[model samples]
Every structure is written in structure tokens, then in C-alpha cells.
Target: MSAPSTPPAADAARRPARGRPPRLDQARTVEAALVLLDESGLDALTMRRLADAVGVQAGALYRHFATKGDLLTAMAERMLADCSTPPPDPDWSGRLTALARRLRTALLAHRDGARVYAGTHSTGAGTLGFAETLIGVLGEAGFGPQEAARTALTVVHYTVGHTLEEQAALQPGDQGPADPERLREAVADAGLPHLTAALPVLTGTDFTAQFEFGLGLLLRGLRGLRRDGSGPGA
Candidate 1:
């Protein structure tokens, strides 16, 4: 009798697993990637690394995500979940403020989370829907589409940028002037009278306070622009 023929590689590729749970889908893979990201940071994440974390062949991931960019995009969408809650009734400004706070809190929760966010455009359905809701609220509040869109983007940019800087602020480092004495010495050497005068005000204020202060400035400026048309010949 002829020896039993072995299954060809091509044939095996077409066959399904008999009893094991179905292989992970894109969402599961994405979540696994995010878990790895939280633990290992964005720089250390690789397809091989993710598959190993998820207990699957690296090749199995390709069945879900075709490329790293695809995986990154998926991760970015999950980031928006923190910020994309439904609007609270009759309180648009409150709604917007709450949204920004939520986004900031969520981004701060992970290691280099904002970096993942910054890498992706993050204009997926969930984000766009949130954007639409924001735009509609702003429009009803007397802003045009152009103004609303720009304002929405500004809020998002400020939120992400502030959160990134906050993360850096908290990371262990000697980047800040090491002490009050060092700060005084630097200020005295520079002889910038303004810096010396403001040192006390600036010294103790942490990132949370700075964020609200900066947000107020942007929001105030936007309001001023709307009211007085802060432009030439307006």
C-alpha cells in the first residue's frame, strides 16, 4: 500500500481548528496590544510581542490586522472611549468641560497613552460622533461651523498637549530646576525681572491647576473673538 500522504501546507492553511476557541478577533488583539502598551510602552510593542502576550502565533494576528498601522488605529479608537460619553442635557459648556476632563484623566491613566493618541488621527466614528455633538452644541451657542470645528479641534489639541506635558512633569526627572535655591540662582543670573517677580506664583502651581488656567485662557480668547471679533478692522 502507498504511504499515507501528508497534508500539504496549502491544505493546512485552508483547514479550521477542530476544538480550540476561535482565534482572537481584531478587538481582542487590539486590547492585548493596549495591555502590552500599558506595561511595556509604545516603543516596545511589536507584532511578535503582541501575539506572544495574547498566547497566539504571530502569524495569526495577520488574519485580524494587516499592519502595525491598522493595529495602532484600533488602539487609538479605544483611547476615545474615555472621552466619548453622551452629552448631558442643557449644559453644553459643562458637557464640554466634563468631556475634556474625562479625556485628560483617561490619557493620564496609561504609560505613554497620549503618545498613542498623538500618533493616530483619531477621527474614527466614535470620535467623529462626539465631534458632531460638540459642533452642534457650539453652533446652538452662536458659533458657525468653521468656528465650531476650529474650537473643537483647539479643545482637543489643548487637552492632549496639556496631558502630555503633565505626564512628563510627573515622570521622575531632574528636568525642573532642582530646588527653590536653584530656581532663585537661575533667575538672579538671567536678571529677567519678570521671571523673578513671578517665581513665587509659578513655583507651587502643579499641572492640574495649569491645565484649568490654560483652558480658561483659550476659552476666554475664543469668547473674546466671538464678541469683539478680535481681528483687523473689527
Candidate 2:
């Protein structure tokens, strides 16, 4: 009897079936999640949907990521991976400015990318490396450890918040800024002179210019701190 006939069930267990799904790993799972995020926005990137995209069951995703938050953190890390390279500017301020711009560009690479990044406190290599670069630059500019940390946080908050608004305004079906004429009329009717006067620039969609302007303001303040020796380094 053919060596008692090895059990068919045991043979099947030893080798994967022809059409079985590929093994799911953290990297592949995060990649699939990002694709889903780009195609359908953050609100639509659920684990079930991601699992489907990766040819696996939702439970299988948990084997790689314990929770949806874990997956999102990984996605956030991937978004910042390219930003690890330091800029080549000779001046510290110039380097900081370039780094900030690089950060904005990275966040804008994928749909709802800023939102995804804003939600997670990723301690991954990419995130830590970016933070280290920023702090190192500030240190070279005369900021003490505490001051450098706070300054870094402030700059990051500004960049992320600005990009968040920028992305939200550009979302499909979003009404975007109110029409200039309509906004002026409403502000005039409300007797808000200052708001009426600022409407031209206020309602403008020049995110790049606005970002640069805001960044300049922060840099100017930092310059003041360094000049006056008011920061902790002093």
C-alpha cells in the first residue's frame, strides 16, 4: 500500500497551494495602505480594504501591524523617508529653510499625506533622522538643547499645520476659499474693515508663497533670538 500512503492533508500542508496569497510583511502592508490612501483619501483606508488590496484577510494584516494606528504610523514614516537627506546650504538658516521646504514637498507627495503624518507620532528612522537634522542645524545656530528642541517643534508644527490646510483646500469637492468678491461683500457688510482690507491676500490660494512667508517670519524670530542672546544658549 505505497508506504501506507502519506496523508493527502499532510502533503497539502507541507506545500502552499498554487493560488495561495504571498506572505504579508510590514513593508508590503504599508505600501498597499499608502496606495489605498492616495487613491481614496485617508478616510477610506481601512484595514479590511488594505487587506483586500494586498490579497489577504483583515486578520492577516494584524500579524504585521497590531492596529490601524500602527499601520498609519508606518505610512507616516514612509512619507518622511526621503526627507532624511540634509540640504547643502552653507548657512544654517538656508539649510533650515531648505529642510522645511523639503518637508512640505514630502508631505504633499501623496493624497492626504499631511493628514496621515499629522496623526502619528512616528519614532521610526525617517522621523527621528529628520528631527535630528533639524536640531543639529539649530544647535549650530546657537540654540541650547532645550531651546533647539522647542524651536524644532515650533517649526514642525507650523509646516505641518500649513500643509494640512493647503491639502484640505485642494481636496476634490471642497469649495476651497470663498470667492474674493463674495468674501469682500460679506466682510464689508459686517463692517470689519481690517478683514475687508486683507481679503485679497487672505483668500488667495498661493500656498507656496504663503508657506515661504510664514517660514521667513519664524526664521526672522530665530535670528532675533540668536542676535539678542535671549535663548538658552546665551
- Candidate 2's error at 177, in angstroms? 3.4
Winner by lDDT: 2
Candidate 1, which segments miss by more than 4 Å at Cα?
1-22, 89-91, 172-184, 200-205, 229-234
As a whole number from 0 to 100, the lDDT of residue 118 in candidate 1 is 76
The lDDT of each candidate is 0.72, 0.85
TM-score of each: 0.77, 0.89
lDDT of 1 by residue, 109-205 (tens): 7777777777576567766766777777677767777778888888889999988766655555534423667788989998989989888755653
Q: After superposition, how far is residue 209 of candidate 2 from its true place, in Å?
A: 0.7
Pairs of residues clashing in candidate 2: none
